[model samples]
Structures are given as structure tokens and as C-alpha cells.
Target: MNRTWKNRGIVFTLALLFVTVEGFAQGNNNPPPKSPEVHGDQRVTFRIQAPNADSVKLSSSDIPGSMFSRHMAKNKEGVWELTSDVLAPGAYRYRFEVNGISVIDPRNTSFSESNENIWSLVTVPGNPMMDTRDVPHGAVAEVTYHSESLDRFRRMHVYTPPGYESGEGQYPVFYLLHGAYDSDDAWSTVGRAGFILDNLIAEGKAKPMIVVMPDGHTGPFGYGDELPMDEFIQDFKNDIKPYVESHYRVKANRENRAMAGLSMGGAHTLGIAIPNLDEYAYIGVFSSGVFGLVNNDGSVVEASETAYVKQNSEVLSNDDLKEGLELFWFATGKEDFLLDITRATVTMFEDYDFDVVYEETEGAHTWLVWRDYLIEFTPKLFK
Candidate 1:
């Protein structure tokens, strides 16, 4: 912490930046490309300089593609360029893989949106984007711990309910998940989850519950299925759940437990909840795309919309599901692309003779919708 070391660190950082930029500019005729510019249409033109890299590709869960890859073409001088189509307004996490190493744009000084980890942000001009909302929010704590499964310390965020430390009885628990482009802190921070929970709890609208948000993004190939789904399941069933149960005085039962999330996390909630019918009693899906949409191969028949309807129709015709397993909830913003999928899910569940509460609001796939969904969904838990 001495002046000498601090000076050295600054010098080292500058040196690294110089080398990184120079390395890319060496053989290129063009100057380093400018930082991405977001337009009114939500299109983002991303430019990165990497002259030495043989190839570069943009990796993100927000962008739709079979490979989740957006290849950047290098100019004669080695600067790379690629532009994204009009994206939905929300927080989209991405990185530049210069050959292999994940990197943030050095030129863009937007600062890290994800705390402790560095990822850049492009704020789309709009009212409901995650970055634009103004609300009295809650604190976001990113605590790290050693995990036996990952063989290293991992991190998770715990959004303590508004009156968390103050009262008497143990509260219920809600395990929330984030979409593909988000991490544990995405909801509590960007999505205003903590603030929404705080307001609801203060108003005596929501049952007091411990909200546990964990990082759903594991990137072996950026947002690909190379991740260990079974390990994730085990971590939830064994590590996360047990850790929370032991640390916090949360009621441990299906009636007191709920699970929900946005997009990918919504799908994850369903995937985890349906199998563990005895564990989670309430389940919510907010603009869920991964599990609610088509399968990995892009086949229409494998879509959740189709599957839900088919299953529910069969169940209804046979008088199946006389005993409901869980409380099903679905919500999606009107402007969100995932609306179709959510609507289909509701119809399917209804057809199967299950009561599913559905909420369609005015917003897009951004944090605005997710936060709104949480505000409505949280009160329904443990009631």
C-alpha cells in the first residue's frame, strides 16, 4: 500500500494498455476502432483492435444464434469490426475473445456493471432499460465462498428481505435466477430487485422471504451448454440450498419455498422445479426464452409452447393433474419478444387443468419487466 507500489501499479496498467493497443495497431492501416456507439434503434456497433489475433468473435447470451457467435472481421491493419442488430433494451453482457482470452473494451470507460468482475455496458436510449430506472434500491452483496464442486471459491449474492435483520420469526425463501446475460447481482443491482422487495415488504404486501440469487452463467464457450447442468443442479440441491438453510433461519419446505427468474433463469426454474415437486411449491417464469422457446436444434416441435400445450391438453382430456404439484406463474412484457412463448405456456397450463396466474404488462425484455414481475410475484409466495 506504499506510494511506490501504487505508482508501480499505475505504470504497469498503463504499460499493459499501451502494449494491448499497440499490438493490435502494428500491422493495421486504420487507427484503433472507436468504442461501440449505441443508436436509437438499439443497434450497437462494436469495434476492437487486435492485430495479432488470428480471429476474434463476440460472445454473448443476449444475441440469438446457433453458435452464439458474432465473428468480427479484421481490417487490413488488424482492427476488427462488427455491428449488432437492434437489440432489446436491457443489460446485455458480452466480451471480446481475442483468440481465447475474454476482455473488456479498454477504450470504453463505461465502468464495470458487474461488481468484482469487469464487463462493459452499452446503455440503450429508453425509459425502461435496466440502467435508466430510478428507485430506492437495496444493497447488493457479492460474497465469495469456497465450493467443493467447482474446486475453487465461488460467489453468490444474497438479497436479504427489507426487514431482514429486524424481526422475530424465520421468513420463507425464494431462490431467484437471472437470464443468460446476467449474473447473481443483475437482479439486485440492475433489475432493482432489492428495492422492489423492500417496497413490497415495507407495505406488508409480500411475505418476508430470504431471496438467494446466484450466478447462472457458466461460460466454457461463452453462453453454451458446455456448462455442467448436473453440477449446477447438484450445487442448488446440495451446496446453495444447504448453505442458506444453515446460515439463515429460513423455512425449509415446499410450501415456504419458491423459485423464479427471467429468460434463461426462468427456464432453469422450471427445469429444477418440475423434477423437485416436493421442494418448490411456487414457480414463476418472466419472459423465459431458453426453456420456453424452441430446443437447441431450433426445431419447432421441441418448443416449450408446443410441449406445454400438448401435455396440458392430454392431461385435461384424461383428467390428469387432479392434484396440482406447484403454483405456476407466468409474466412477460408486451414489447418483449418472449411474449409469445409465455402466452403459449399459460394456455398450455390452463388446458391441462392447472391454474396459472398470468400477467402481461407494458415494457420490453429489460429489467423493468423483471422487476415488475418480482414485485407482483413475491407477494404470492408463502400465502
Candidate 2:
């Protein structure tokens, strides 16, 4: 009986050893998946194993111009791979489409979402302007405040620069605004604003200040629809500005306050900040301008060269407007669709002797240009 039991034990141990060896061999045969691989030259290669998929395509946020989609090729291993051209160093959003259905990269964990879409994110390092450097980083906090105008609790992302916790002095504030179809999180997530500011402040290129990104949408309007400008501006004044000033360590003065925005937010800056110049000393309008005026009766009045000048005549003609403002900077990409309107607005400002620093770079109205605008604009603040 002892001999029989010992034989059974040996058989069980041998069977366990054989199963372990087989599992190890199988694991070695199948390598781990690597979806996004950033190359040395800033090009990125994305791969996905979709054996059952009939078709696969790539959609990346870094695509220049109007083309946002690219066709990907599938290999014999049922892996779809596509290498992007040399891209700029920044964070980008991308995803895959399998048989006409959008899907996130299964291997990538980082992602960002707008009101309409969810996209996988990839950070291409090596650019210090946008990259996270070995510097003292700031603290970002999401704070909620009650909005009297909107009659709801709105949230904002605030970035306090390095040494803010131990520092004693109140810093200047930059009320940064996001574009349409985006939330308050857009600046830090896709824009990389916090990292950009960190690098700038470390290098002494930008002043250590607080950046407040507020939700520009005041009403329940879908993407591409005109926002409630009056309500948004009122809320910013009545709710957001007061809340930020009372909560954060910020200088509550016009000289220390600045306002800037991109796209629809830029339009809001024009409509809100220009009239309230006493509130914001520095104003930046990027890739957008006053397309039209919102009447009290909620009517849309198309902006004309004459009408623009006529409506803002007092503000444009006032010598104090230019003298009081620290900077009135506007920039737009040369290929941006709104370049003509930006040019018209710049012309209007120049015609009235308003000291507006206008810039035109080589790109369209995308986050790339907006990020560049933030990097350039932040350095000029509180100087």
C-alpha cells in the first residue's frame, strides 16, 4: 500500500511540472502587446491586434489641416499598425476604427474625453515647452462654486504655480478659457497647460501665477451652437471671479488679472473682456474674434467692419483703453479658417491705434496652435 501511494504522488508531481512547462512555453511564444511606440524622431507607431476585424483605421488629433483620419494596414499576425509622420512634441489624442466603429486602443490607458467623443492619448516627449521637465511642478485642484447666473454648481480647474503653498505673496491670475465642445479640464488634459507653465516658470520665462480654466458653456447648447455670451460673462463676474479670488491666493486687481481663450472661448473673450477691460488688463484672443453681436432680445447680428467699429467705438477710441491694458495680443494660424475674421479684427484694432500684437503662424485652428499661443502668451503676462 505504501509503494502504491508513493507511485501516485510521483505521477501527480510529474503532471504538474509538465503543465507548468507548457504554460511557460506558450507565454514565451506570445509576446506582450505594444500599441504606441514613440520613435526617436518624434514619429509614433500604433499597433492593434484585431484578428477578426475586417477593416481598421487610425484617427489622431495631431493630424494637420482638415484630415483627421488615416487608413491603417493589417499584418499577417492580425495586427493593424500605422506609423505617423514626424509629429511635433506634445500630447495627442488618437483612436482606432474597426469596421466603421470607433474603438480606443486596448493597450493604451491614457485617454481624454469631450462632450461628444472619447479618445486615447499619447504623449510624445522631448519638447520642453510642453513636456514635463525636472522642475518644481504646480498643484492643480478642481474646485466647485455656485453660479448665480446659471443657477447650478460649476467646476473649474485651478493651477497654482510652484512654491505657492509656502509662498506668502498673492500671485497674479490668468483666467484661461477653453474652446467649444470642451470642459474646464481641456486646458490641463489636452492643452498640457500645467506642464507648459511649469517649464516656463522653472526657466524664468513666465511669471509664477495662477491659471483658472472655467467652463465656457453657460447654457445647455450643443457643439457649434452660439453660447449665451451675456450669461457667461455675468457668471464669470458674479460667480467665478469672486469665488476664485476669495478661495485662492490671487491679487484681486485689474493689473494682476488677465483673460485669454481659444476658438469659441476667444469669441467670448472678445465679447466679455473687451467691454470689461477694467477687470482684465491683458487679453488674448486666439483663432477667433467677434463674429457677431448678441442682442438683448437674443438676436444674432452679423458683424460688419463698420458695425464692429461702431459698436466698440467708445472702447476702441478711448486712449485709456490702450494705456490701461498691459497687452492686447491676438494670434491665429495662417491656415486657420477664421484667419480672415482675425485679420479683420486686427485691422480694426490697428485702425483705432490699439496696440495689439498680432501673430500668424503656419498651422490651422487646432490645439497645436492654441498650445503655442498659451506658451507665448503666458510669458508676456504680469511683466
Candidate 3:
């Protein structure tokens, strides 16, 4: 009787152990492991549990040394994983292509939508310039106003510095602009201009000021058509400026007003701000494909005796105009496709003997370079 009872107990214990092991195996097959594990040195590891997938590829945007499509290795547990090299500090968008179909990271919820493509977003921390530190953040408001130029109610994003509401002092204004095919929120969302300014102000690196980002697109037009530069300039000057100055406690004068932009908006800055030097004390042209100076083939168009060039030359030649100008800044990436044009523009400024601050850094025509430009440019403004 005792031997039979001991045999039964042994059988029961073995059965319980088997059930636990089976449950663990089922759980392992149920869901994938944590993905996008950002490490201390900025290296990121991505994982996905695709037991039946034939192939997996990882695609990313703006990650240095990243391949167009990196093959992921699958483990015995059917878990596919790939570790990326140490990346710079910035927000990056990525996606996994499982058997030719793109999908977002199931484990990561952060995402960004551009056109129709949705990409998983990951931000490697440690960039103080772009990071949102424990500081007094400014208020970003979506303002809607009737555009007399477009004959519609357009929206803009305005960033009022911390203490702006309580402070009685009028602050200087920076008329920030976005590239083509982007809305006014581009500066706040993608460019992160608000956080950049917050950290700069908190650390005493930049003066507390208001930033106005306006949409550059005017009228119902598709891509490839010439942007209505004249309409945009007039609306900015006649309509947007008045609305901003009236709504916010801003110093509405040339000495306190500054304008800067990137890409197509940079071209607009060069066209609008440089010619209207008396209206803007500070002008920043970043990665601007200077209209006549840059050709369609990315070659430098020689300084011609065209009316446009001649007009800019005349405006920059005046000592009084140059002296009145607080800051005439131009910056571009060394590897930018528009580098030749930027260099030519600088040469034209030099030829005119204008006091221009030209900056060149190692990067392509991307938001990473533009963020750096904003950090360096803001400190030099309204000083």
C-alpha cells in the first residue's frame, strides 16, 4: 500500500511540471519581446517575433551608417532581432518590412505620419539642444486668422516664451518659416523649435522671445509650380505681422523682428527679407537654393547681371543698409545638395562686402542640421 501511494504522488508531481513548461512555451509564442530597446550609448535594439515570416528588413530615416534595408536575424524561438550602431541624438523614424509589407513597431507607440507613410518614431535621448529638460516650457497655441491674400482662414502655430503672459516687458519676435509641403506646425512638431528655445532660455543661452511659424504655401497649387513668393511676403508683412503684434506683447520693429527658414522657405527668406532689409533687422537663409545662383542640375549659376541679382547687390552694397542690419546669417550642411548655391550666395555677399555670417557643418539637407542652426542662431539674436 505505501509503495503504491508513493508512486501516485510521483506521477502527480511530474504532471504538474509538464503543464507549467507547456504554459511557458505557449506564452513565449504568444507575443514578441520588447523592441526598440534604447541603450546607454544610444545603440538601439529592435525585436519582433515572427515565427513564420520568410524574411524581415529594417528601414530607417537619418540614422548614420544605416543601410537602406538591414536583414534581421531570427533565433530558435522565432524571434527576429537587429541591433543598430550608436546613433546621434535626434528623433528617427523607422519601420519593419515583413515579406515586403511595411509595418510599425508593435512594441513602440510613438509614431509620425508624413503624406501617407506612417513610421515608428524613436528619439535617442542626451541631446540637450533638442531634449525637453525640466525647465519652464513655453505655450504653443494654434491661431486661426483670415488671410486676405489667400482669401481663407489659415492657421499658424505661435510659441510664446515662458513668463510671457505674466511679464509686462515686450519681447522680440522671430518670424520662423517652414519648408515646402509642410504646415505651420512643422516647426513645433518636426523641428522642435519650441523645446529648443525653452532649454536655451532656461540655461541662459538665448533671450526669451516669441516665435511665429507660418505656413509658406499659398493658394491651391500642386508641386513643381512656382511658389507665390510675392503673395506670401505681402501677407506676412501686411496681415500676419499685424495680427501677431496685436495679439502678443511683441516689439514690432525691424530691430526686434527677425526671419529665417529652411529649403524653399529659405529661398523665400532670401527673396523677402534681404530685399526688405529695412523691415527685418536679422535675416537667416539656411540651405536656400538661391534662385538665380543655383541651377536645376545643382551647379553654381555664376553671378549674372540679371535684375534680381543686381537688385540684391545694390541693396547689400549700401553701407547704411549693412549697418542697419543686425545679423545677416547663412548656413548650410557641407554635404547638402545645395552647398554650391549656398557657397555662391556667400561669395556674392562677400563681393558686395556685406557683413554676413556664414556657417558650414557636417550634415545633409535635413532637420538635424536645421536644429543645430537654430541653436547657434538664437543666441546671437537680440543681444
Candidate 4:
């Protein structure tokens, strides 16, 4: 926090800028290539500086075709380049495999979290729902708050709708959660929660509301391990909700609040919102359901499956819990890995006589589908 270090930080930044500019100043050279150039035709050309490697290939989820990995042509200057077929208008994450070692695009500053790994972001704007149109925008702020349940500091992104800063009216709060492997930044970034809400508000399709994207990741665990879901739920109930309600001009009633999440976040939403139905009137589950109860082969685990059936049976059977419920919506892609999970969840709610609206759409479990789910779900909230 000292001025000396602050000045040194500025100097370091300027040095980096100067070095990059100085490289271009050396005329007729392209060693440091400008990468991820989006063309008007929707084709994206990517260039990377990896001269020493034997082969450099592009690896991306958005890249068309099998493997999503293609070798790039190397030039005399050792810069590797590749141009892809026209891509859809949406956000895409990509990284390069330089001689088998995966690496991000050094030239791109826009990037996002992908589970345990990181990837660079590229946006090809065309869709009205996903495009950054000339509409009044909202503010996405990174907020830090202390969690008493976990005894640690946590971070979340809060999106205030347009005119919220100057308006005096208290806005209803929508608690949006991100899935496993993603940080608190996912919703605000690749999920495009803020922009989606902005466009919806601009079109008068959705009411202006405060979106609270909390960190759902609780512990350090990899795939196939049991995530600390209860910890996250407790943190949400004790820390995240209180922080937002106290800091922002939020409506304090149960009807003015909503909760939704995708994948692991959907699991969290079910865990938090259902048992505490008096708090969240609107609930949405996207591409996820009760996990750990059944194995991948469809066999139920006696320990988890039997226990959960008895655990929330009371709340599930109680008709009084649904009195103030506005909506219980669920959406999942037919090809999503969690499609079965979602189906089971919908079946369970239906069996319990809970009025559930389920929609099966096309696509898999990805940010694109989640964004679409948000667009469809938000308009139905806080009504």
C-alpha cells in the first residue's frame, strides 16, 4: 500500500507496455504475433509465439470438428497461425498446446475460469441475446466479504441494473450461483449474466434487479470427489445473503428474492432454496440434480441415497412450503451430461406434487446453454 511500491507497480506496467511497443517499433518483424483476430465474416484467426516447439495445435471447446485440436502452420519467423471456419456469435474459450504443454494466448487479456484450468476468451458478437448492443449497461462489481461460517474471506460479483445507482427504489435481489470448478467470476464473465440482464431490462422483458453471483466452490476437491456442498449452502445462508441484503438496496421480503444456478450450482440452489422456501419465492435449476446418491452406472449408494430420501422428506411433503412459491422452473439440454440428473430431479418434484415446469432444449452443458437459460429464466422472476 506504500507509495514506493505503488510507483514501482506503475513503472513495471509501463515497462511491459514499452517492451511490447518497442517490439512493434522494430519494423517489418512479426515475431510477437497479434493473436485471436476476429474477422467480419465470423472466422477467427489465431496466432501464437511458440517457435521452439516441434508442433503447436489449437485446443478449444468452441472449435468445430472432432478433438477440437488442429495443428497450426508455422512461419519462417516461428510464429504459429491458424484460421478456423466461421464460428457462431458467442463467447468461446481456447488455449494452445505447444508441444503438448497447454498454454493460453499471451495476447488476449479476456479470459475465464474452466474448472481446474484456465482458458483465454474470444467473443464473436452476432446474436442479439449475447451481443453487447447499444443499450444502457449495468455495473458488474467484484465484492469481497468475510464468511463467518467458513472463517475466511470470500469474493462475489454483484450486478446492479441500469439506473440502480441513481434510482432510489429498492430492487428485488436475484441470487445467481456458478457451478463447480468455476469461481465467483464465471457468471459475470463467460456466463454473461450482467449483459443478459442488461439486454432484458433494455427490451422491457425483465425487471431491473440486483444479481448476486456468489462463489459456490467451498473446498479444494477434484472431479469424482464429494464437494463440500453443505459448507457452501451455509455460507450462502449466513454470509453471502446477509452481505448483499445489508450493503445493497434490496427488498427484504421473501417474494422479492429469487435463487438459481447451473450444474453444481443447481444442486446448491436445490439444497438452499427448497429447505428455506420462506426466503426465495422463485427457484430455478439448470442441468443438475441431487448428486452422490447414485453412481455413474445408475446404482444407488445405500449410504447417500437412502439417507437423502429421508433427510428432506418432511420439507418435500409439506404443502405449506409451496404457499408463497412463485415459480419452480428447470431447464436442461438434451445432450447435457447432467440430463439424467435433471430428469430425476424433475421426477422427484413431480412425485412430491410440487408444481414444477421443466423444459428440455437442444445442446449440452455449456456456458452457451446456461446463458440461454438465464435469458429465459430471468424474465419470469420477481413477478
Candidate 2's C-alpha lDDT?
0.79
- Per-residue lDDT tens digits for candidate 1, residues 1-383, read 64323643554355346436566456535555686778778888877776677878876634444136678888776667888887765545556766766676665655333423545455555433234334334455776655676566666788775545665678788999887666676776556566667667656787666889987754432545443355666667767888888887799987788899888788777667755655777888989733434444544344334543344334344433335445688888898877777775666556556677888889777664676677678888788
Q: Which residue runs of candidate 1 sit more than 4 Å off their true CA positions?
A: 1-139, 166-168, 221-228, 289-326
Candidate 3, residues 87-131: lDDT per residue as tens digits?
A: 778777777777776677766777553322355678788899899
CA-only RMSD, every prediction: 8.1, 11.4, 12.7, 4.3
Candidate 4 per-residue C-alpha lDDT over 24-50 given as tens digits, one digit per residue, 9 for 90 to 100: 554426546787999999989998765
What lDDT score belongs to each candidate, Candidate 1 first? 0.66, 0.79, 0.78, 0.81
Q: For each candidate, give its TM-score against the true structure.
A: 0.61, 0.85, 0.80, 0.89
Error of 3 at 226 (Å): 5.0
Clashes of each: 3, 0, 0, 0
Better of 2 and 3 by TM-score: 2
Give me the runs in candidate 3 sitting further than 4 Å from their true place.
Answer: 1-35, 47-56, 65-81, 96-107, 112-119, 219-231, 296-299, 310-314
Report the lDDT of model 4 for residue 108. Answer: 81
Which residue pairs collide in model 4, if any? none
Tens-digit lDDT track for model 2 on 244-322?
9898889998899999999888987887777777778999999987664434454444444345556666777788767
For model 4, how big is the CA root-mean-square deviation? 4.3
